[model samples]
Target: MSFFVRLSLVLALLLAGGCASLSQQQRDQAQGIAVAARSTEVNCDRADRCALDSPLRALGGQAMAESTAQAPRHYATILDEGELSLVARLNLIRSATRSVDLQTYIFDTDDSARMVIDELLAAAARGVKVRVLIDQLSAISDVHMLSALSGAHANFELRVYNPTFGKAKLNYLDYAGSVLCCFRRFNQRMHNKLLVIDDVLGVVGGRNYQDDYYDWDREYNFRDRDVIVAGPEVREMAANFQAFWVARRSVPAERLNDVGKALLRGGVPALPEASFLHPERIEWVDEEAADPDFINQAFVATALPVQSVSYVADLPRKHRRERAEEPLAGQHLTEPRLDALIASAQSEVLLQTPYLVLSKPAQKLFKNLRKRDQPPRVVVSTNSLAATDNPIVYALSYKYKRRNLRELGFNIYEYKPFPLDAPIDYRQLLPPALDGLPPVPERNRMIGGSAAGSNVRGSGSGRKPSVNGSEVERDVLRTETRPSFLGTRAVNRPLPVTRKGARMGLHAKSMVVDRRIAVIGTHNFDPRSENYNTEGAVIIDDPRFAEALAQSILRDVHPDNSWVVAPRQKPPVLSGLNYSIGKASEALPVLDFWPWRYATDYEFKPGPDCPQPLRRQDPGFHACYSAVGDFPEVDVGPKWLLVRMLTAFGAGLVPIL
Candidate 1:
């Protein structure tokens, strides 16, 4: 081992030795507090949990009662907008009558997170069973917050999975020690995002409990997707939650190293009072959630009646050896099921994900599809260098451009950081009745103003440039909380102020095959998802649902919203020699120094001759489009340089990222 590895192991051992345990008296006192919290019920007269009246929740209960074994009917709704997604979650959570179980990868301390924590605590106080499971590295790192939760309520409980030093929080040194002592276990994470209520309804997708995921972040936001389902399949979701709840690595908060130590030293305390930075916005949402008309229009009217829907999830440990020991084990559920769906595609496959790094099996499957006599059209929507939060992963995608374009036949569209037609409601960022910001324009509409003589109506660089400014004070994650836990001091780095406002990155993981099948879940369709993280998805075989999903993804790829990636035009002199050199350099595992690339970004020219987007190989493509540099709107600086360096040397990090 190297000197650094040896030092890390020694420090890790010291950390293990420092872990504190509770004494018998302390343990008894903690249990007594839990019992008291559980017994002080506020809604003693109600048979059901004291759930708020909500039409959306009523539909979920109705669906479960009406479902049958022969034909399992489900009410499904596509959540394509960030504000609506948050509202849907809030409504469903408030409507839950029996229990609420949540599992996620990230639960930060922000406005959105505080809102959720408040709701869950209130639910627990009203005699509803509440449980939350978060991965250790990215869970709450505040010792005070963890302690408050540990003694908050008897019905409320929290668990951390695979803690490195048996602690709910990690310091910088602990993070380094974990990587050195146990790299494999450190890299494995529980990436599943799910919320089930009363064993009757569930919401699953890529949105996590963070301000950015809900478009409440001032500097950045995510254009994410999720689906709310109500039917017999929710029972399966409940069972999956139970499995993870009892998984070997899932450790309760009160039993953790730091939390246990704190509880022993300090007696049980009441849950801290919430002080939201934007109480007006929260109150507005709460009022709207209770409005019957708004609930009907936003959620109930959008629901689709589907007959065939099933949920697939990976086992908790997510390893082949671990699977062999369990009676419920079999082949991994998520990736193979997706592969089967893509292989069965007859015409086209519309896929949207933040990352595009393919696993070996995935690459092989696509290569085989390309070799077929008549291959399906694969259209992928992903992030550009300017839009992606992880530039290292983007570098790997940049490195494999030639192979992905020629061998796999992928027509890729990179999302713009400040797309013209982004589907975000800017009103949520301000107080209840603020009129300073520009109103949200109709999506996918073009305005006439740009140098190209056309612009997206609500484009980032438009009249609403200051929409990024929030009057409310922000509750940001502390800088010293936990650095490099997920391979970086901050999991998401702020984008270059190139556009001067809020930037959006694609976080929706979905696929539509042949306009007949739809999938929405946490799978990124990347190597890390396939190999390390546990993933899950809800598959619907209804044509109507597929068409809705297809339209949503199609809007993201509109010319006004994204840039098309196509091969650069070949030079007339020594074209063959240049091509040969490029190919040879791309084959190298490192030191790929060739400057010219096989593909570059292309912008569509709106005119009489080109009414629609043409295929990359179309003979008239050059007339309808013009080449923009490989990285547009990206400042020429460290991040830009890092992309080049990683593209040349970062191939090894693909599988783990």
Candidate 2:
């Protein structure tokens, strides 16, 4: 045989072998495990009407009035760190004798995530019906982990809320399809985080199933807060879960066969077998556990409830005029609620937040109080430069924040790291140096004493100069007038400006109105949260509850735990040069505003070394910049980017990804 022919045959053989191996791998990954289908259905329309007229009506009304009273009411404690919240959540799941419904934004394959999975599997093993509904985007992200949970138990049933097959994987052909699907899926995201264990106990809050949220790592521990309800409210949360569960977008886990087998082989960690068959060892507490005397004082001194203590959110309208101006506007308790609650306020409005970037409307709301005939004191606590995990967000925030709020005549405070009694060190809280060094402050000293006999100006230049003339004159004057001017002309110095208020507490997001009613929820007052992400929360009506939560925040949480932003007496002054530079940066256009411009112009551009002619437009610049700029660079690597592109494109067609 000729040498050329032999080489061709060898190449063919190698290609064929590679193709067989790839096919088998794909087959192995695609194998699906069957999941037994079971669900608990509650008709909310019927219940809503029945609830208004039933004996439950009187119970809910009375409960609303003295909601904070120490009755034998059920409540769940939200622990902020470690496996504490997970442990609490799992314990409730295990104790369930009837039905368990769990819904979350993200469920990972991490230790804590797997632990919950194992427990759910066990619950299903014992004939306790368990339904798990997770967002498709999140589930597909952890398909392997979720599939393992599905394969291990028949009683366990899982569904993906909004799934797009081609969009989910995005191999080469799907990329084009995904682009067409992007628009419909981009704005629609499932931001609800809930866990309803049985129709009796429920928890709704901000924390997600990630390590950073649980405080497993000191560097990323989120200072967050959540609420647990034990009464009829649990039923409401359960219904919310069902509404999303049965929605057209949701699909059973059995549908994703390929993803399931991979997860099963990976094997979800097994739950430790333990019995909490009795309630005694559960460490569970009810409303009665809270001191009654303190509870009574809280109720009697409680301020009126915010306007419409119970309110519902209106969905975004499809038509322009009918659309709610802001989809998230009514999610929290409104300004009328704040007014009624804040009416009796005497001293202060203290706010603690990890992310303290407030919108223009929010800024106006806080500023209006300072405009009052006799404005009450107001203080804010937020993260300093060194303490924040999201520096980009902080940079964009502090850029216009202080000056705007100060201009509105409100005292703006920034959190600084210092001992509780120590003064703030303002320079330390400035954006951290890239090389990790403390910023040096420039000194400008003015000398005017009789011994010196003249005014002298010390150079305002930050760096020290080599000149010796000023030092010689200063030495002679220091020796002669040191004793004469002592205690004679005391310089009236202001308090040492400290950066003590810059480290805001974590995870707890709340608004206290007149120390009366407090609105606590998973929503952070951030642009990403307000405009981009979906969120939910409850507006508690009880004054005692609000006061207790508020005091807990101000006293225990805010003092040593949080940094305080110092309130400025006047608006911050910026040079015209700086103002112009800022305006120019804001005016510059970015690609997120126009998504498709980059594909042909930048993405398909050939390399310079290649002999192929360069395209007139380098679409790669748009593609490259858009990916780097718009999406969070962390955790989402090249492969994830490819997936995101494909998903986004697919979402454009399906309207659900």
Candidate 3:
């Protein structure tokens, strides 16, 4: 074993040895959750009435009413606009007078998180019952600090799923013990992102609650997508929120330390005596909302509905230890439901996900599609090695992803990092609200502007660029065509000074099938999502929404935004007979040669001949280029070797990626 690997294992064992049981106070506080949540019951189970009309009824109710009447389900695709997504969530909280339920995997303690949290607090202040359920690990130290505030309000409740054992200041110790002790169950987690307000509207997609999710982050911004739904389907969506909210594994905020009887009664800072424990609420202000806020755009534009809308989610017990031996049947439903959705596709299947480790069903589907008389066209867009946040997963998933899938006749496109100066057309993803808005110099909209050009109308989506699908884009990924590799040069333009450098990575996961159905969710189309962690999505049987989603996926994979995953000879075998023997001695993960590297004799600016870093710097996308132009280059590293070693150690568990 490598020295570092042995050292890490030893450290984990040492930390696990220090494991301690919960204190009596902690146990008592955990019991307090039942007493606390009773103040306003979460009654989504009742078929008769899931939720009563809130102040939103006074705001967007009429539009929502008109929208449902015209369609089976109302939906809108949130393109690359992070600001607008933040605005949408803010508006949902702003307009909601009744209740808000937010469930997310990662809620970072960044500006975007602050905005969302403060808004939820304000909503609670206004008597809108607020419920937030975040994964225990992803809830960073700052978010963990809110336990006292949860003790402050009955209307506002915070729950952590799969609470970790270690309270070590650094937090790393907790992950080590948790994963080591109950490795399988602990490994399974909730990966869904949802926000349901008053049980009438919900936002579902791949984006999480962090700066990267909102595009405000300087270092990295996801070219992600989300959908806002306003109609009958939300009732089921709200039920999904309730499923996770009240699960057995969830712990109330009061179950934590720094929480006591005093903070419980104080509510938000808006209430007298609440200032000391909860200071964020002091600066909170409730503004009168614009009538046709950005959310209005969804109901207004996606009025034409489809045959049906189904909000499907895995059961809460997906990760339950007590039920680990139970049949997978009732424990998980998302994957099966996802399969049913895929089976319904007829002519074409357009998939966009950040991770793509083909599950058995996925492979079978591709095989069948390839054999069909006149098979439906299938195109997939996912993160290339350089752009992925999880290179470990990329290494595990990339082996033969193209060769195998392409041999089955599926075309694949890998997302390229956006140039610091790329212009994303906002109207294509959002409503017309962004159409005419003048460039805000403070926000730097012109250079990477989604809100660009004179004709600000949301129309003309067809006019936008589709660089990844272009022939030149294909040539870059096609390994057969030899090109001259050349020296590195500084990109023609300078990177901006946006407080933090910009990063453009793909996190959007959605699919449009035959222009007849749309499936949007957090499912990554990987084994991890399939057999392990839970996931959720909203499947809409509507042509208009599907087409719009289809167009969006096409635009994202365009050469300007992505690189084609054309065919290539197998990647070279691992070097050194010992290393090869060692790898083959155990289970190897992805064995496919990575086709993303520049071809031999590659001629291009900032070309392949230049030395590339094992890790790309923030906004470091300029290192690689193609015939068309330069974009961010994929970042790979020694970590790939480390991940392989770790995966081999885990053996049976490693495929969870």
| Candidate 1 lDDT over residue span 1-657, tens digit each | 999999778776745643444665665665455445443556545767768788888888889778777877799888776766777778878888889999998898777788889888888888889999998877687767887787787788898888777777766656666665666777677889999988888999998898888777756678788988988899999999899999988887777767767666675556667777667668866776677777777777778888689999987757435544573366478988999999998889999998889888999989988988999999999988888776667888998888889889999999988776666755554443543644446432322212111111233433333443444245344211134545436644534645565677888999999989999999999988888788999999988888888877877887877899999888988888887888898888899879998999999997899998888889999899999888888887876777888888888888887
Name the 10 consecutive residues with the lowest summed lDDT in model 1: 448-457
Residue 509 of model 1: what lDDT? Answer: 97
Give the number of the best model, judged by TM-score.
1
Q: Rank the candidates by TM-score, best first.
A: 1, 3, 2
Question: lDDT per residue, candidate 2, 1-657, as tens digits?
Answer: 999999777655544432222133443443332332222233232312122121212222343444443433333232322233554556556555556798776665544455566667666656666888776544335454444544555556777765544122223222223334442443344556777755655666666675435433312234455555555465667776776777666666544533544434443433234333223312322121123332222221221222223321112221112236675344433233443444445556655555666555556665676677877655454544444444334434444443434444433333332223111112222223321333344221211111010011122212111121111111111000011112222111111122222222245555555565555555555543444345556566555555655654553222233322322121246444444454443333321112222111011223454334221223333222111121221233443334234322321211111
Q: What's the best-to-worst order under lDDT?
A: 1, 3, 2
Between candidates 2 and 3, which one is better according to lDDT?
3
Q: Per-residue lDDT for 1-657 in model 3, tens only?
A: 999999888876756553654577655754474345334543244432323233333333543565545564353444345555665677677667577899988876555576677777666656678899887545544433554445445678778776655221224444455555655655567788899877777888887887657654434457777777666677788888888888887766555433333234442222222222123211221221233532344233333344567888887877754544666647778888777666666788888887666766677867877787887778888876556665555544444343344456656666654433223333222223423444434321222423211111233222332222111101111110011112111111112222222435677778888888888888887778887667998887777667767776776665555665432232476334433443344334434232242211111234365444211111433334333311234222454444444334433433666
Which segments of candidate 2 are over 4 A away from where they belong? 1-33, 36-83, 138-140, 164-184, 256-352, 360-364, 367-371, 374-379, 408-505, 555-559, 567-657
Cα lDDT for residue 176, candidate 2: 26
lDDT of 3 at 445: 28
TM-score of 2: 0.53
* Higher-TM-score candidate of 1 and 3: 1
